[model samples]
Target: MATTTISTTNIIQMTVNDNDYNSHFEGNLLDISADPEAYYRVVLFGYITPIFFLITLAANILIVLVLSRPTMRSPTNLVLLSMAVADLLTLIFPVPWYFYMYTLGYYKFLLYPALSCNLYHVMSEILPTFFHTASIWCTLLLACQRYVYICHPTLAKVWCTNQRVTRTILAIFLLASVHQLLRIMPTIMDDNSIIMNTNNESMINNEPQKACRQVIAKWTTSIENLYFGTYFVFRIVFVHIGPCFLLVIFNVLLYNALKRAEKTRNKLLNKQQSTEQRNGSSGWNKQQQQQQQSDDHQQQRKANRGRDANSTTVMLIVVVTVFLIVEIPLAVATAIHVTENMFTVDIVSDRFLSMTIIFSNFFIIISYPLNFAIYCGMSRAFRETFQQMFLKNLFTIRLTARSSSLNPFISTATTTSTTTNTTTTTTTLSSSNTATATTLTRMKNISSASSKGHY
Candidate 1:
């Protein structure tokens, strides 16, 4: 067996006997000889990416529709809307198109080398990276919104408005664009190349004194040495690892606050129950009944906060988890690739890492789209709104009557009665909006109390 390793110039080199020869290719078009596994690659990707496309497409569309409804348009919902858009960009453009191009490249359906280069560079690399980065930052923004809502409720009303959410989303994309542009520029932008020698002295002699003048974006030795060496590690840490830690920590703090609130509410409830038991059934008059109702409402509100925390945490954990699973392998693979290219190690000489990365990339494609499932499953509020958005008119009355039935834990009993003219949804969310705000306010105090205790 031959030893194959990525060379110092960032090109793969296979050691061969003197009688054997290394073929030299100048273009980015998939060479049938070098890539014997292209057929299986096509078949695997054909089945996988389309599944991603359909699921992601349907899920994000549902999310958009659900969030676009009147009562569902909260500040947190706006952040979610932004996330759906960012994910949709990837599904709409980069993902499906890659399928088309990959199929074409494998089967030689369209042999236009120039076009293939453009497709690979722009569609496969740059555009997807752009939206993927946007999707990541949108998640960070959601975490930030949650932080404000749970930890600083007084500021959430002021800071977590529609205009601010829009501006923040825009700023995120803008920064992501500039940052990713710099990262990907080494791939797309023109650069001088030091093309590798293939052990064919005559072919090397005949090779152009200047590297191939035209390109579908390509990374050259100069670009790698200039940009990638300095930025690759930093990019992975800053954009990938750091944000993952931030998200986990934010959710942890939010979860702790909810636990504290639940503890306090439980103690109060137990104390009230014991007092009522001592007072006995004969003492349960109209005034006592009213006070008990107040106590029940308090219990319901506490339960609501806990339910809200669980649902939100479930979605966040799943999304962040999928992201970590999808992205971490690719990041590690790329890091190993860069290290091998720089130092010429043969630690992973086979195609396993590349295949792992390709499959992992599919999940990343599907991650942004799966949030709809998370929302629908973990949240009664989301399911209710989703039904009203899509399954309206036909099932509105039946479903609306049964909306809070899915999870009584999430149902807000503190509703302010509305005129008969108002719709059920209007009354439900109106009260829900109040309850949510109040719960967050209590959580704010809980956070403050914890802070004071620690201090």
Candidate 2:
């Protein structure tokens, strides 16, 4: 390998370096030496991936916490919660292993039966991919539901009931789980070969050896490649490109419909207001004015809801795009490796490129905790609920646990002490009304002070 310095702008260029052609085994060497810049790129990714994972975990936990409250449940929120759960998984699982090995120096976390490695591999890879795909797909469903409700109000009134939405969400979860589960099989057992653990040490010339190596040969590689390639193509076609295009189209339609609805509502409200002003004190004018105000209120609410939906849709799109952009290269690279003699240098570059993707896994883990932040950013109601729960924790909690000293005798003793002190210091100037006023003021101050103390 030859060494060179690279700028931030050329990092992606480095990944797609098209200069050399070599076989997978011969083509590229993993080197921080060849391109010191590549090392920095990997290191930079290492730093960001963990941070993103933490953010994601915190955010998703917050979402779950907020939604778990009984009062917080709603049809839309239920869907949001599901998406958050999926996003949380995306951010939580795989990155921890990377972080553990790279940062914490704790590899060999999977020390179970060698079979467990295959299981862990399947689970570690499949679950996150499935959940993320579900999250993206769910966003599209939610957007479509909102669109129906907003644009075709009459049809929505009939078809978009809470029950229907719940069923749809359940279906999505089940389907996504199944779809993603299909990909998991490749990691477990490729073709007719099971990834078995064997302590079988070969004896060379009747001499036993302690050292043994796990073998995955060319036949297995070909089989694994076929499985990965099929899923890779499926994911690119259905999960990545399909959902992205659908979301883009859905959001565009949603935006137009919302705008048109706002215009119509404003027009009606204005017309009604003009009718009221011209009619001048008739019963009809009063009725029209009231109706216009009501219309304005409803329009404001619709506009707010539209804005929330749009924001959520956009954030979901960001999550999906980020996942795809980071992950696709690895799949493509691996798939290309299947065809032994294709572009050799590109394959080596792909192998090196695959490292960047592997390092990027932490970003997704960090995103798991972040699903709540996305919701908070996108939805006013969610933010309001979050604030009410955490920001106003004192007010939100209902407890009457006053201090032990706040009893009747304690209050009387304090009052008596104050009165005695006042008697010694003052010239008998207090009337009954004044005394009553003074006591009430003292009590008010004490209550206010107590409330402050409680908080």
Candidate 3:
């Protein structure tokens, strides 16, 4: 049996029949045919990337489907839809390309020239940046919209318009593309290629001249470092630090607003309850009791409204938190790799270290697709559309089960209440049911109003 061993110094090398073959690593791709150990690494990625690509592609497609529905096509949903599109691009272009390179022993379409390498790097960087930046900005917009809706309901209608949201998304994409283009130029242009031979000697005759162009300069180091440093600073701000700060502030403001609303609701409920108690006098108090009950019903409606607002805030926080947790470490790692002076093939060639970084890239790509599930779990509108679009049968099954369970209880209660209740009691029961129905109808109307805008 043949054996392969990987270590810090020889992670990119393999010994076969008393001879060693080393893998040559340049910018975005690796030459692994010479190394048995390196082949294992590529094989690992080859097996896994296809799975991630398909899964993520499916998830993002589902997101688009849910967002495309006329009822779900709010400004918020539109932003999410764009995010899904960007994420799909992120996965579709980059991961498949990576898998191709890994499985085939070289990058296919991207190895045309050193210039082509730059183009591919720019593309690879741009797609990730576009999707990630768009997601963060969209989430921020949604948070602000939510803040406006809860903190200033009347002004929310005027401020958070569909036009403004569309413009914001456009601006985010344009700005991200520009920034990514500028930041990446220095890294790509610093190509310095040095040819080496099969005997580990400088060989001019047998070498592919294009692959010889590598990026190495003492000056290139400073320029590249500056470029990566700038990128790192921006990434930390835009992706991690900025979003976290906004989330904290938004949650604080939302909590305060909800607290105030809850206090008002509770006070009103207490007042209505007191009024009912004071008016209590059997038949004489029945008229007064009905009026107080109406006020209590209004108070309950307000309380429910506040609860819904809180629920939305909580959901946004969860989604943002998940995104930040998954992507920030990868950002930090890339930052270190690009900016730090200590980065060399020697440090990077440690088998464990290389594997860790390689695994991080997988998650980074996979994270884009997972956002749909996050949105579904977090957003009520998304969940409803998703259920309607895909889980309709499951919903019907659950609805039937609920109906069956409730039928016997509802019938028994109706019979008991009819037998025991007098005219006044019947009137109160009627009013209670009317209030409940009114609340449900109002909710349905709001949902329908939003639904009408989707097409």
Which model is ahead, 1 or 2, in terms of TM-score? 1
lDDT of 1 by residue, 284-357 (tens): 77888898779778877977776686577557656666666677777777667767776778778648767766
TM-score leaderboard ranking: 1, 3, 2
Worst 10 residues of 2 by lDDT: 24-33
User: Total backbone clashes of model 2?
Assistant: 17
Q: For candidate 3, lDDT tens digit of each residue in 30-59?
A: 223333355554655566777777888899
For all candidates in order, the CA lDDT equals 0.65, 0.57, 0.62
Better of 2 and 3 by TM-score: 3
- Those runs of model 3 whose alpha carbons end farther than 4 Å from true positions after fitting are 1-45, 104-119, 152-155, 184-194, 197-232, 248-290, 334-359, 391-455
- TM values, all candidates: 0.67, 0.60, 0.63
Question: What are the per-model C-alpha RMSD values against the true structure?
Answer: 16.4, 12.0, 14.6
Candidate 2: tens digits of C-alpha lDDT, residues 1-455: 22222221121112112232212211111112123344443454445667776766677788888977778776666777777887777656756544554455333121234454444455456777777778867776766766676667798776777677778888888888888766554332211111213221222233322211122333445575566566666766676666656666766776677577668767866986776576566556567768867876886787667566556545645544554555455445444554433333444565565555555444444445545556677667678888888878765453323543356477778999999989964544454467777887899999999999999
Give the candidate number with the greatest lDDT.
Answer: 1
Of 1 and 3, the candidate ranking higher by lDDT = 1
lDDT of 1: 0.65
